[model samples]
Target: MLLMMAEVLAFSRVSEALPNSTFWQFLSFHQSHVEWVGCSLHDLIQPSFSFLVGVALPFSLGSRLAKGATFGALLRHTMVRSLILILLGIFLRSMHSEQTYFTFEDTLSQIGLGYTFLFLLGFYSPRVQLIALVLILVGYWAAFALFPLPGAGFNYTLAGVTPDWQYNLQGFAAHWNKNTNFAWDFDRWFLNLFPRESTFTNNGGGYSTLSFIPTLGTMILGLFAGKTLKDNVAPNQKIKKFVITGVLLLIGGLVLHLTGVNPIVKRIWTPAWVLFSGGWCFLFLAFFYGVIDVANYKRWSFFLMVIGMNSIAAYVIADGLGAFIGNSLAIHLGQDYNLLFGLPYATLVKGALVLLIEWWILYWMYKNKIFIKI
Candidate 1:
């Protein structure tokens, strides 16, 4: 979560601010997903965030159940949390805007949209959860696959996509093409139900509300991982399960993409992407669990634990108050103050300062035991 937050609130902006060089350019690329084919580190952030929410759910559910909370109470709590996440997502996207954004493609809204289902799955056995995951991935894949593909002579230029965008796969694959998919069509109808600055068209990034379907699968993978962690197994056995499952999922996703059965597109949240990103999430959980909980190497993780512990606060403040902090710094310190090596570096300095401020806020919260939960 800290790494993902840093990418959004720090590295991406810094990459743009730094002078154009091989290393910086590479950093920039890693900070953004490939146009239509492959994933990037930045692309994993949302999925990772969603997956971690699932990973944490087992623990949360266990606590509530142990406290004698009824299933009805749990369901109600889940609904309320889902509502807050959706509303918070919309509110955050509307930041600095004149009206409510009503966009459900943001990470918060996407998670919110699928969170209740995830919570429901948390009560089920691992076998049921696995079946649910398969059903979600397959059902979502079928939705796009069965959607009629754009006919021949369809003008890509007219669709606002690149004239020669990659992976214009024919037949079923074409049904998932950028800006021309079923999800995009649904967004036109769905988003238009609310107020808008203009008629809802396409998300500039090729994302859609329907990505939540596959995102649920990502969370399910985490749900399974969480179950594995919570089960009464040896630490080594649990870690082994995580690593092995992660590797298998990674290979499975890669094979699907390579064989052209599914294209690994992050924007549309393809089934392949769910497996791919979920694999990475598993690996990440394994690494962290092994290092901190298993090996007891706790001291080095203190800084990260601060941000991780108060992720929502960090995320909301970074997106909501980040620009204000940067502007304040520029106003008081002078715009030229951030110009370390050159004018191009100004944004880098300002972004770094903003990140520092965000970290300090998280740190303060951590010290005060003020963790904010949805």
Candidate 2:
């Protein structure tokens, strides 16, 4: 429920489905991505999901390690899992027909990279992880700042094909990471530079080695958070620490933006964005953690847990089954309802219908204990 609300309602494909109506225009804010170079409530959905994965890492891996899991076991597990995720991301990036699918802009690939980094961070302590986080964020900032684009300073100088931040980098990525579940070669040899391959798309590029830097910060922050939750400290103490940390991150990010060291770009996952987004993640989860674990208010979290439990499944289902039924099927069924509402109210009602239908699918999965982990 919490996760799904974050994903489905987190975006506006549904709103796009009803452009002719004022109602949709009003609700459009909820369903769309941030305009560009700024933040919005909708923008946090993907990073928050990744951050949640980070929060779960300590509990899951620590449990196995406590039971005598070996270092090799952990590494092998992490590698295999990341490979599977890379494949899954490749799959999602290719989900639609060739006409609809492009080389980048898939969320699963981002999640795959995030999980892989989180796996490695699990081997380190919070203090050490914090140092690495700073290095990754600052290191990438400097790297891009020094690396020249064809026609620009420091930023990627992608060909004029698109006005995106990284034109050359994404195409540079597309040449090798084009999707065979593995691309055969850097056949364009001149384009290959970075170890990881990512394609450029108008929406955004996934698989960017550059984006990984701040995203790594997101994971470290999550690890720090996960460790804090394990402490047997008092509730007020926990709240105070998280609140202070969140405030500091928020304040620090704002101050840095003012200095212009970072501009808080979401598409590129800038350092400022990482700090800002992670701070919100900390603040948001702190409240939830305080209530559920600290105050023993487990019942209230149940609604969110419903959506959270089957989160990945819900994402897959939404990607797969959602359009057919809630869209075309509903249109067919609406021979009756459509007569009453027309396109205006009907479109709004359709969004509600789609959401309810998606929730029910989640409800069904929950009842059956059919949780799918990536």
Candidate 3:
């Protein structure tokens, strides 16, 4: 909750500081996903999320390992969790829309699928897991770039494709799930396969299908992180090594770009993108490790740690409450109360109020221990 508040405020502040009407434009830039062939701070969000999943795995699964959980127990746990996440995503996407049709391809769904794969990777040895990550990345790259786009056989370039494949995929997803895509949010193609998410390449399904790869990489890194925390490695040495390694990965990612292998496109999930963002994730881990663990700055991290402790809850609060409050309150206030405040400040005030409302919602959840989980 705290982190969400801070992140949202930082976003709005960045937008506010822009000159002229650039505030709106910059705000859009921050809120909107990046186009193909580039990385943005926004792109970091999903990977960070995936990384968080890995961070939790050891703690959660370690308990299972300790409690004498069998293979059957682990499989059941994985399946149930994935389904819950997937369904939750679909439910969130469809919540306020017309009830005539159902929707698919939500973040929850991706997280569900992604988490299942992440656990599987974490279940294995790090060496094998790393190899799997490489295969997934290289394989997806080949699938999107080398293989022709469906229905455009022998033509691989995703340029000028009308109606994103995601729509078609959702259409299929809706059918399998006994529902239909909302017209406003997606195309109504029937039985569409592989609903696309943000693509690495244009239409490449940004971390969509390809996410399983980097996601595994993210988990692998987390495993190392868990091991670090568990092991007695000197804090100072770990911090130094982490800083140096992160810097090298960042630099190496850049050097690869200079050599013209692939641009650092987040949409396409280029290997370079993985190396770069994954490097930054390492840096983030280092900072938090240094501060919270090494420096013992527990007080400062407490708020984020609260939200981080229930990170998934924060995701719902940050987005779910933001949308629900913003839409309903902004409309009611602007349409009904604008006569008093006038249009100029009425909408702005409503937006601020909505943010406050979301904060309170999260705060309430935190206080009551009413976190919604998968």
Candidate 4:
């Protein structure tokens, strides 16, 4: 969550400020989303967030059960939470629009769309979860593979893709190409069902509501990790399991990509992407789990903990309040204040100030025990 906030609040501006520096250039590459294919640090943010949701489920369910919550009660709460998350996502996306956007491609909405299924799976055995994961990935893959590609006379321009666009995949992999696959076609029909200023043609980034299916796969992988953590295994064994699983997932994703069986496109949340990104999620969990939980070296993470504990608040502030705060800073501090460091670094200066204010807000919330949980 801190990373997600930082990417918007400060990282992009800082990267822009140091355009000629190799270090910042490297950071900038990861800070921004890739156009169509492959992964960037920025791309991992959504998957990681989704994965952690699954990781938390085991603990959440245990607590609820221990509190004598019945299955019906749990189901009711999950449904309400899912609805709120979906509406919250739509609300956030519609913040600058003329009306409610009614898009389900937002991260929160995508997760919400799949959360109930994930919640139900949380109650089942690991074997069932694994089988479901396989079925989802394969079934989604087949659906796309079976969807007819655009015919020769089909106009790519209408779908926001140029005929000669460099990233357009060829052959079998084209099934997952941007704005030209099953999901894109589904959106054309599905999104148009909602009221709109104009007909919904395609998502500029090629993200689709159906991506939630594979996103559930990513979450299932996290569910496995969560179950592992809850097991009565030794710390070293847990770390080993995570590392092995991470490597295997990475290999599996790469093999599919290399063999042209599937492409690792994050935009559509392709099945291969579920495996690839899930690998990174596991490794990250292992690193943090080993460092903070296993080694008891928790002091250094308090700053991050402040934002992470109140993540929903942090997300809301980052997405909704950032421009407000930035404009206010300019209003009160003088428009030229950020230029004190020089014109090139003006964005950096302003962004840093905004980020600081955001952190302070989170810190205040932390101090007051005002976490905004869904």
RMSD versus native structure for model 1: 2.1
Residue pairs clashing, model 1: none
Candidates in order have lDDT scores of 0.84, 0.63, 0.58, 0.90
**lDDT tens digits, residue span 210-250, model 4:** 99999999999999999999999999999999999999999
Q: Write the per-residue lDDT of candidate 1 for residues 1-374, one digit (tens) a residue.
A: 55554553344555666656677777777767777878888788888998888889999999989999999999999999999999999999898678888899889889999999998888778889889988988898888887776667766554667645665666456677898887887887998999988877778889899898899999888888888888999999999999999999899999988887788899999999999888898898899999999999999999888888888998898778777888898899986888776765566677778888889888888889999998
By TM-score rank, best first, the candidates go: 4, 1, 2, 3
Query: Clashing residue pairs, candidate 4?
Result: none
- Residue 111, model 2: Cα distance from true site in angstroms: 2.8
Error of 1 at 360 (Å): 0.6
What is candidate 3's CA lDDT for residue 155?
31
Clashing pairs in 2: 1-306, 1-307, 11-31, 12-31, 149-157, 158-167, 158-168
Work out candidate 3's RMSD over C-alphas: 7.8
Query: Candidate 3 — which residues are off by over 4 angstroms?
Result: 1-32, 96-105, 148-210, 327-351
Runs off by more than 4 Å, candidate 4: 9-19
The digit string of per-residue lDDT tens for model 3 on 178-226 reads 1111221122232133343432223223323334444556556666566
C-alpha lDDT of candidate 3 relative to the true structure: 0.58
TM-scores, all candidates, are 0.94, 0.79, 0.73, 0.98
